[model samples]
Target: MSKSFERFQRRKLISSYFSVTLSIALVLFLLGILGLLVLNTKKLADHFKEQIAISVFFKDTAKQVEIDELQKSLVMSEYTKSAVFVSKEEAAEQHSEEIGENFLEFLGYNPLKNSIDVNLNAAFVSTTQVDSIAAEIGKRSFVEEVSYDRPTISLLTENVRRIGLGILIASAVFTLIAVLLINSSIRLSIYSKRFIIKTMQMVGATKSFIRRPFIWTNIKLGVFGALLAIVALFGLLYYLDLNFPQLGVLQDLKMLAILFSGVFILGLLISLVSTYFATQRFLNLRTDDLYY
Candidate 1:
């Protein structure tokens, strides 16, 4: 009977350890997916910002030298990423190609004006800054008009802002819920060993002494879970890259490294915190409460 009872206790201990490790692994997996989503969303937003172009139309009488000077000025500006000059002839040729030979014959002359297309740095892509930039460029003597898709820029800015804010709020809410769920899981795992805790307490074991082994066990399991999550995330990214090379920018080594490091730290912190609190609660529990 004594040997059978000892065997049963060992089995229970093994089962409880597996359960805790599995729970932590599941939580880490969920967090990893959420992290990837947030990172990719940010990259997409930046891509959209890069596509916003500002068109600077040159005056009909504007000389090549004046246009060159204006291009130099724009290139030197803090807000500009790049300035590309499109000569009137090039613009006319492009329009003719699009409309075919018939349209050019009817028009008689190239009415397309010379223009400089300016790409702004992502930081200055906001609606307010875009308006300010247009106004600044309009003051130039060679600039007939400054044209940009104002409605499109405004829509992009608002959408990006709202998406970023939504992601932040969702991340916060998910993190809070994850922590609570992980804590509950850890508590239940510890509860399975309540009798052991009670016996240790009765024997006058110090709280630190009772907690050290559990904390160490949790740390190891947490690291293992995080590594598993990292592997899963890398696999997903690799698959995406293979299937859609257009999104290859997201495969940047630096960004992936940052995300992996963050997940590792998060996994360790969550496990350690949950273990500490769960163990503390068990340690302070009344003898009667142990029955539950």
Candidate 2:
């Protein structure tokens, strides 16, 4: 071969390698994002559920001491994440602030009852659990009523379940697509060197000898791709933490570590497997089939 032709071949090889690396990085990046969503789905749901509180209103004759005792018991309960005692005056003030009017002034009496606002743990925020908790609390002698937005809890539970299932399904589909995408890129890369592979085989290169370099090179490609994807994923998390701090995207360090590690492993595993199978396909083909 002329030096110019060899140079052309070299450039083409480099170009194909670059494309494969980029393709792996892009697919892994998307998978990383989906993985993030999957890992944080429960957290997102819990945040909203925590916002919905169970209001335990006291009877008119209930004393502050009794209310305090009940509130303390609730705070110690496993289902309760937090419990705040709201006096009738405080409830009236909140209502007034919400409506932009002093209803107490218009009515000449404060009719609001003293209540304990109970924020439940995420696990107990569903409709049935909340109702059961409320019923259990209502049996208290000082408790007049135990109330929460049953309809809101029901809707939230349903929507969260649906959304979580949808995300899981999407993650599975995307994972398969990522495999196919990376596999195809690897196959195309290997296809370019099929003739060389056949030549080596003709010269008594064992299957392992023929496969070693391709597997190693693609493994490195996978590592580079995974690293690139990780960097992009970190950048995204940083942006989210900066702009949407409420999401607490960076709060869970352990889960983040697991996610990042999974990304790295997945990248390496997929690339190794794809490259092996792709090269094997060409290795098994006849020399005459190279034109196809």
Candidate 3:
């Protein structure tokens, strides 16, 4: 009966070890997902910054020479990426197609003024900078008005800033919660081995001697968890890229590599830190307190 009881205890210990390892792996995977979301948010914001365009409208009676001069000045501006002059007829046609109706017929003529469509450098796409550029452009003698979706630009800028802040705060909070939870799980796992720890203490085993094997075990568990999280992150990214080709631009080799590395490092760091703290707490527990 003693032999059977010993075998049953061994089996239970092995099962508990595996359970703790799996839980660590799951926590690492959650950290990886959070890292990916933060990195991708920045990448998506840059993509949007590159696509926003600015439009410059000319006066109704503005001459082609004045328009050409304005275009030249804009082209020479430091913030300008590219500027193209759109003749009155082309603008009218574009408006007609966009509105899905003959706006010229209702006006009895092409009331649309000639304009220049300007694409600014990505770095200058912010609301304040874009407004400054528009002011500079409006100072020209032939310029009638500088038109842009001001509210939309303001909203986008505000939203991106808010999202970035929110992500940072949430990531910090989640990381703290994750570490505490993981540490608690590890402590529970170690609690099951309290008898072994007590036996070592009773057998003249130094604290370092008792801890060495457990530290190595925890390291191995951490590496395994990090690896699992990396695999899961890559699988999710692959599916997203396959389903959403519009996001293909974000799949750049450098960005993907950075993201993968960041997630892997995050997993490894969280696991190691949680394990170290959990083991330390267990090592310091009094024999009397071990029951609790």
Candidate 4:
């Protein structure tokens, strides 16, 4: 081959490689964002559920000793994540701070009952479980009433569940799109080299010999793209942490590790699979079909 012609071929090959890698990186980045949302959905849900609590008020005749005992028992239960005892005075003070007035002074007496604010685990925060826990706690001798907004809790749970389901469905659709997109981009990258493959075939190159370099090179492209996507994902997360610190609570190392590993494996596997099938398309085509 002429030196100038060989140089031109080399440039085309390098440009094709760069194009495929860039395309894969962008697609993987989009996939990574969807993956993050899917991974963090549970953490966000748990955070909201942890905010829910039930207030248990004791009877007027219930003594401090009896209330303390019942509080201890409630805290020991698996359903109870935490229990905070609030004296009538503390309750009055809290109400005063929030309402900007001391109702006790106006009424000539403290009217609030001694209560325990009970926070449940995520699993127990649902409507059914919370009701079951409330009923069980109410059976205590010193407990007068166990109060929580059942309607509000039920509504919130339903809304969150629905939103989570919607996200999952959206993620699935996006994932499929990502696969097809990466496949098409890689195929087009390979399409540029179809004539070269035909030339090699004419020179007695075996199918494996022809496919080997393409498969290996594209696998490397997939890994590089996935790494790029991972870096971008973390960069976005860091910005979120700096500006919106509350979101930092959802950044668990274990889950993030899973996400990173998933991104890499997904990119690698999809690229390997797509490249194999993509090369096969040209391998099965006739020399006459190259123009199409």
Best by lDDT: 2
Rank the candidate models, highest lDDT first. 2, 4, 1, 3
Give the poorly placed runs of model 1, Cα more than 4 Å off. 1-15, 96-102, 249-251
TM-score list, all predictions = 0.90, 0.97, 0.86, 0.95
Tens digits of per-residue lDDT, candidate 1, 97-141, equal 887764557878777789999999888998899999999999988
Local lDDT at 56 for model 2: 91
What ranges in model 2 sit over 4 Å off? Answer: none
Write candidate 3's Cα lDDT for 1-292 as tens digits.
9999999999997787777667777776787778778877986876677567778888877888888888898899888888999988998888889999998888898877788989887667888999998998898777888988878778878888999999999999988877776677667777777778877888898887887777677667767766777787778778888888788734577866876686567656665676666666777778888877
Model 2 deviation from the true structure expressed as Cα RMSD, one decimal place: 1.3
lDDT per residue, candidate 4, 110-222, as tens digits?
88999999988888788889988899889988789999999879987998899899999999898899999999988998898899988898999988899999999999999
| Clash count of each predicted structure | 0, 0, 0, 0
lDDT of each candidate versus the true structure: 0.84, 0.93, 0.78, 0.89
C-alpha lDDT of candidate 1 relative to the true structure:
0.84
Q: What is the lDDT of residue 109 in candidate 3?
A: 80
Candidate 4 clashing pairs?
Answer: none
Worst 10 residues of 2 by lDDT: 63-72
Ranking the candidates on TM-score from highest down gives 2, 4, 1, 3
lDDT of 2 by residue, 133-175 (tens): 9999999898999989999999999999999999999999999
